[model samples]
Structures are given as structure tokens and as C-alpha cells.
Target: MKVLALLLASLAAVSAQTEPWCRCAAFVTYEHSEIMVFEAPEVTIDSCTDDAKQCKNSCTKELNDFSNNGNLWLVQENGLTVGQNICTYMADHFFYFIHNHRVYGYFEVCGGAWEYTGVASQQLLCCNGGKHEHCISK
Candidate 1:
């Protein structure tokens, strides 16, 4: 009976693929940039919090430095609202996302660096108990 149980448990564990991606800690969103007409300045700021202001600035700078022609943007112009909970994904030295905050919605980067918990875009994360001063470099 013990052998059977152990084998079953092991099999269950093996069933779920757990490689390349791990759970991510809570990260805060600062600015919401919606994708408007491409090739034109059509980005609308959906929202912005005072707490996450600096973090957003830092993240944007980091992203611009990380990408080409200031093209690698952290928040995809995909109607992402500010103060939402979003996870980061690393794909071959570059983390990618289509402004998606839902856990299951991340199909392309699912098996990448980080995986978020649960579902829903209504779920928002906070940094430093909402002060968000320490939201950078995470």
C-alpha cells in the first residue's frame, strides 16, 4: 500500500510540468499605457498612482535600455490599467508580455521566468504597503 501511494504521488507530481517558471512576488503597476494607432503617438494613460510613479519611471527607463530604439516597452500598449498586479517573464534574456496580467492568459511566456497566481485583472498588488517606494529592481 505504501509503495502504491508513493508511486501515485510521484506520478501526480510528474504530471504537472514545473520547469523554467516559478511563482513571482507581488509587483505593482504604475502607469497604464493603452495601445492606440501604431506608428503614431496614441498612447493614453489609463491610470497612474502617486505611490507607483517613481517605480513606473524607473521601469520604463529600464525597459527602454533593455530594448531597441526605445521599443522594448514594459507595459504593452494593450489597455493595461495602472495599479494592477502583473508578473514578469524572461524569454532568452528578454522578458515578454502583451500587457497581460492574468495568470492563464500568459500562454507564450507560461514556461518562462515567472508565473502569477490566480486569475482576474481586478487583482492589484501593492509595494511597501502602498507607499511603493521600494517597488523597483524586483
Candidate 2:
């Protein structure tokens, strides 16, 4: 019986694919550059309570620094006001999301690296970004 149970448990574990994607608590949009005819500028406010805001800014600057004045963006959200799931494969730079259970629809980062959790094996890691003072100001 013990052998059978162990085998079953191991099989279940193997069958489960741990897709560690960044889960956001609010809808987020990241624009790497200015869109033609789209005058709305990217978020310049550093109001994220976590590193999400800085991460977004880092990724944006990274892309823009190497591009030929072209714009790229990625939006991850369920609806107009709901959070969405994001993965590293969706863009060139790695991204992650932050959720503050203290409030509903509070903070979220669509595709950016705000802080490093210190765990080297984490899935959603910042490509070349780190912590920022403003990310924790609030």
C-alpha cells in the first residue's frame, strides 16, 4: 500500500506542470515607446507600493535605448478593470506582478522587474532591473 501511494503521488507531481507566470492584482499596460497619433504618455508616476513601477520603467528604458524610435507594448488584463496573467515569454525583458491583498485592484505590474525576491530560482525575474526607492514610498 505504501509503495502504491508513493508511486501515485510521484506520478501526480510529474504530471502537473508548474507554469509560474506573474499574476497581477490589477490591470496593467506597458508601452515601450510613443505611439503615432496616441498622445497619451506612458505612466511617469512612481506610485507602486512595491518594485513594480520601477520595473516597468527599467524595461521601457532598456528597450527604447536599443530601438530605432519604434514602439512596443504588452497588455495583460482580464477585462477593463481586472488583473491579468503575464509571462516572461511575452516580451524580451523579464517581468513580474505584485498583489496587495490589503486592497482590491490595488497594484499590479504588467511586464517589469521591480524587486528581486532573493530567490534565484524564481520564474518572473527582472532582466536588468532592481529595487527603487519610490516603489516602496507608499
Q: CA shift at 138, candidate 1, in angstroms?
A: 25
Residue-wise C-alpha lDDT for candidate 2, range 1-138, written one tens digit per residue? 999999999999967834322322221223463111111123334433354655444434433332212211222243211112122321223333332211111222434433321111111212112211112222
Cα lDDT tens digits, model 1, 1-138, are 999999999999877744322111323232573211111111122222222333333334332332222222233445332321122222222333333221121111222332222222332232232221212232
Distance from true location, Cα of 104 in model 1, Å: 25
In candidate 1, stretches whose alpha carbon ends up further than 4 angstroms from where it belongs are 22-138
Question: Which pairs clash (backbone N, Cα, C closer than 3 Å) in model 1?
Answer: 35-77
TM-score of 1: 0.20
Model 2 C-alpha lDDT versus the unseen true structure: 0.29
RMSD of each: 17.7, 17.7
